[model samples]
Target: MAMTQTQRYGVFAALALVMAATRIHLSLFHHDIWDASWGIFFLAGFWLRGSARWAFPLLMAEAVLIDYIVITNMGISFWSHYCVSAGYWFLIPAYGSLWMGGSWLAKRQRGLTLSTLGMAVAVLLVSEAACYVISNGSFYWLSSHVPTPKSFTAWFANLGDWYLPFLQTTALYAGLGAVLHVLTVQMARTSEHHGQMQN
Candidate 1:
């Protein structure tokens, strides 16, 4: 039951659309309490299948589109709104690397549950670190609009303001992502077993 080229393309295209929609929906509707974007799902999909070249581009495009829509609707400047979107190119690779590493660990560990948890945490930490460093540096050094913090104390305070919410969001999303990965793997195993029994 090997997938044909057409089938593979279809799968990739469908997943890309789904990822885009999920990201836009989450960004718009799920802004309170916790934000659940296609980021985790993209990472999980890449983990399960390997490279997510299409997924990453689709995710970034969706983010940019959402930024435009939000800006137009809210009467905000598009540049200001899209500043966050600009970081996705760097952030996606950081998380994607972690996902790939996690997938390797899962393969090596013979499908242990703990391996999945470790992968999720690894993804979270890598993503947060990459985003924090890149985004903060851009704000401080590159961007003229964002006021650079004057002192070390001010910079540290700014870092806390940027990092804390990100940490909380990543923790919540990573926990959910671990659970989802486990459930998906379990279901896949169950289906395979059932198919074998039928055969």
Candidate 2:
């Protein structure tokens, strides 16, 4: 069955809240936790496939706003070490790849049958790999912070360093989100059925 309008709204709210809240949590404490920033975007693409046109750009802009506020409050200048080049805009394509992967997932998938679950895992792996590669690879090569050309192997090695964390974090959150979404929806269906039966 298709998601109801209300269910769609719930998902949108949950993802937006997770993105905002997770960033705050990470910013508050110094830790090696995986960054959920792009994970939110990745999931948003899959779960919010129909919402993509507005969702992607909105999330991108939201990220910029959050970064600005977070850095400013921390006494750091947004202009100083953040967004100092046109290369920063590379995030558009970097994140676009994730959105594309997710859109693909939505087109080819539905409920989590075993085969579908297998496909979902593959989608997550490939999507997050693309996410890390584009996001990190662009930063490494294009940013003024490291304005040096790297060999092909060296560039890939750098990608590897971040590949697992991005993949793992996104997979965890997206997986959990998918499961919870299914459960919540199932529970609602059951309640509705019981209500009709009681009547």
Residue ranges of candidate 1 with Cα displaced over 4 Å: 1-30, 41-45, 80-110, 148-152
For all the candidates, what are their Cα RMSDs to the real structure? 4.4, 2.5
Kindly list the per-residue Cα lDDT of model 1 for residues 1-199, writing each as its tens digit. Answer: 2335675566456545654565566556765444434344434443444444664455456556765785677677776654544443454554445445444444454354666456646655665565566556545444555564556676667777778776676566556655665686678789999999999
| Candidate of highest lDDT | 2
TM-scores of the models, in the order given: 0.67, 0.85
lDDT by residue for model 2 (72-168), tens: 8878877665544556677788777777777787788766567777877788778777766767767777667764666778887877776776677
After TM-score superposition, what is the CA distance of residue 1 in candidate 1 from its true location, in Å? 15
Note the clash tally of each candidate. Answer: 0, 0
Q: Tell how far residue 181 is off in model 2, in angstroms.
A: 2.2
Clashes of 1: 0
Q: Model 2: how large is the Cα RMSD against the reference?
A: 2.5
lDDT of each: 0.55, 0.74
